[model samples]
Target chain A: MDVIRPGSLQDCLRILKTEHTIPIAGGTDLMVNLALNKISPDRIIDITGLQELKEISLSDNFLKIGALVTFSRLAGKEIAQYPCCNALREAAEKMGSPQIRNRATIGGNLVTGSSAGDGSVAILALDAQVELTGLDGIRKVPLSLFYSGYHQTAIHSDELLTAVYIPIRPGTSSFQKVGKRNALAIAVASLAIYSYIRDSHFEQIYIAIGSVAPTPIRAVKTDLFLQGQKITSGVIKEAARIIQDEIAPITDIRGTADYRRKLIANLLADQLQQLSESKN
Target chain B: MLSCKINGEEIHSEIPSDMRLIDFLREEMNLTGVKEGCSEGECGACTVLFNGDPVNSCIMLAIQAEGAEITTIEGIAKDGKLSDLQQAFIDHGAVQCGFCTPGMILAAQALLDKNPHPAEAEIRHAISGNLCRCTGYQAIVDAILAVSQRK
Candidate 1:
C-alpha cells in the first residue's frame, strides 16, 4: 500500500486524475474499513493536509462547508447559533461520540451515503448542493441527486467532493433521531424539517427522512402538501399521514419497518408542532 | 516510514499505511496504554489527543498521524508525578477495573483544557464517548469536576 500526502488541492486533484487513489479526510470511516480489510485500494490519497478544503464560510447567501470540516467544528457554538444551521448543528452534535465527531467529516458522512447518517438527513432537508471536483471540472450536484444507491454516491471514483454549499435563509429547523441508546448508537429513524414561515402559514417547507428509505430522501410529496398551508393540528396530522406513505422503510437490526414508519411520522409531526408553537 | 511527535517525543519509524494508529502505538511504539476495546469507532477506549483534540486512535490510520502531535496516557505524567487530573482521579476513586481510565482521563483532559470551568452537563457531554462498565460514571465525573474546581 502506498500513501501520498498532497500539500495542495491542485496536487491532490492531479494525483486523482492518474492514480487509482482513495482520498481520505479524517479517516474515521475509511480507516476502520481498511483495518478490517473490507476495502483495499492500490494508492491512498491523504487529503487532510490540504488546508484549502478545511474552510467553513458564509458568503453570497450561501454557507460553504469544505469537505474536510469535522463534525466537531459544525457543532461549535459559532455554527449552532444560526437558525438556518440549526438542523445541521443538531445532527452533527447527535452523531457518534466526541471522538468520532472530532475525526468524522461532513464529506465522509455524505459520501458514505448511509440512510442513517445524521448529516445526510440534515443536509438533505437544507437542500444543500455538493461540489464535486475532478480532472474534468467542478460540478455542483444537489444533495438529493448525489446518492445513486445504498452506500453509493454520484461521485465518480476519480472525483473528490470538495465542499457542500447550503443556501442560507431565515428558517426554523428541527432535527430528531430515535436510537437504541442516547450516545454512540445508529438512529432507528431520523427526521429533519426546515420551514420558512410568514405569519402563521408556511411559505416553504423542506422535510427529510432517514433510516426509512434506501437513501436519505426529501419528503417532496409531504412538503408539497404542507406548503402554503396554515399551521394547525389538522394540517400536521394529515402531513404525518402523507409522510408515512411517502417513506419506504425496511426492517433492520435497529428497528422494524412498521416501527420506523410510525417513528418517522411521530417525529415529523412533533417537529412541525414545535415549529408551529415556537412561531406563535 | 512516518515521523510524528508522540508523547512529546519526535520519533520516526516504518509503519504500514493501512495499520490503525492504535495498533501502531501498541505494537510498534509499545504504548499499550491505548487499549483496544472495540475495533470499531463505537467504543472510545482507544481515545488519544491528536493535535490537542481527542480522537479515537483505533479508527485512524498510522499514516494519518504522520507529522501530527499525539498525547497518550503515558505522556500525561511528568517527572514521575501525576498531573492534577490524574491525581484527582485516584483521590476520587474514579478508577475501577482500570480499563477505561486512560481513555476517560484523556477525554476529561481535553475538556478541561478547553473549558477550565465546564458545567456538569458539559463534562458529561465531553466524556459521553468514553465508556466505563465499572464505575457507573459517578466517580469519574466527580474526579473531572474536582479538577475543574481546583483550578
Candidate 2:
C-alpha cells in the first residue's frame, strides 16, 4: 500500500485526486474493511495528522465538528454543553470500546455510511450537515440527504468530508438505543427525539430512528402525530404505531425486522415518557 | 517508512504501509508487551496510548504513528520500577493468565492521567475497551480504583 501524509488540506486534496487514494482517519471502520479485502486501493492518504480537520467549534446556531475528531474527543468537555444530543453522547460513549471510541471518528462514521452506525443516527436526528471539500471547492449538504442507500453516501470519491454541522435545538432533546449488550454492541434499534414543550404540552417534535431502515430516517408521520398533541400515554401509543408503520427494517443477524419494529415502538414510548417527566 | 517517538525513544523505520501499530511495536521494536488478541479491534490486548489517548493498536497503521507519541505496556514502568497502577493490579490479583494485564494497565494509566479521581463507573468505562476472559474484570476495576484513591 502507498501511504502519503500531506501537510495541508490543499495538498491532501491534490494527493486524493491525483493518486486515487482512500483517506484514512482513525481507521476504526476503514482498516477493518480493508483487512477483510472489502476494499482495495492503490494509495491511502493519512489525514489523521491534519490539524484542520480535528476541530469541534460552536457558533450562534451551529456546532461544527471536524472530520478527524474521534468519539473520545466528541464526548469530552468540548461538546458537553449541548444536552440536546445526550443519547448521541451516550451512544458515542458505548460505541465499540473505549479504545475504539478513542480512535474511531465522527467523520469516518458518516463516511462509512453504515445504517447501524451510532453517530449517524443522532446527527440525522439533530439535522446535521456534511461539509465536503474537493477539487471544485467546499460545499455543505444536509446529512438527511447525504445517504443515497445502504453502505452508500453522497460523498464523491474525490471529495473528503471535512466537518459535520448540527443545529442547536431551542428546547430539550433525548436519544435512546437498545443493543445486545451495554458495551461494544451495535444497536438493534435507536431513537432520537427532539421537541419543544410549552404550556405543559409538546408544541413541536422531531423524531429519528436508526438500524430499522435503509438509512437513519426521520419519523415524519410519527412526528406529525405527536406535534400539537399533549404528552400522554395514549398519544405516545398512537405515535408508536405510526413509527412502527413508517420504518421498513430488514431481517439481519443482529435482529429481525419484527423485533426492530417492536423496539422502535417501545423506545419511542420510553423517550416520550422521559421527556414528559423532565423538569425542562 | 514511518518516524515517531515510542516509549520516550525517537525512531524511524522502513515498514509496510499497511502494517499495524501493534505489529510494529511487537515485531520491529521487540516490545512484546503489546499483544494482538483480536485483529478486529474488539479486544484491547493491543491497547496503546497514542498522543495521550488510549486506542486499539491493532486497527491503527504504523504509518499513522508518524510524528506521534506512543506509549505501550513496555513504557508503563519507568526506570525498572513498576508504575503505581501496575503494583495495584498485582496487589488486587487483577492478573490471571496475565495476557490482558499489559493492556489493562495501559488503559487504566490513560484513564488516571486524564482524570486522576475517576469514579467506579468511570473506571469501568476506562477499561471497557480491554477484554479479559480470565478474571471477570472485578479485580481489574478494584485495582484501578485503589490506585486512583491512593493518588
Scoring model 2 with DockQ, what do you get?
0.79
lDDT of 2 by residue, A22-123 (tens): 999999888888889998899999898789888878897788889998888777777778877665676676677888888899999998887778888877
Model 2: how far is A66 from its true place, Å? 1.2
> TM-score for each prediction?
0.97, 0.96
Q: Write the per-residue lDDT of candidate 1 for residues A1-280, one digit (tens) a residue.
A: 8888887888888888765578888887787788789898888898888787889888998999999999999988757767977999999999999999999999999998999999999999998999999877999999989988889899988889999999989887879999998789899999999899997888999999899888898999999999999989999899999989988899888889999989998998899889888987
Task: List DockQ for all candidates.
Answer: 0.77, 0.79
Rate residue B85 of model 2 by lDDT: 90
Quick one: best TM-score, which candidate?
1
Model 1 TM-score (B-chain only): 0.98
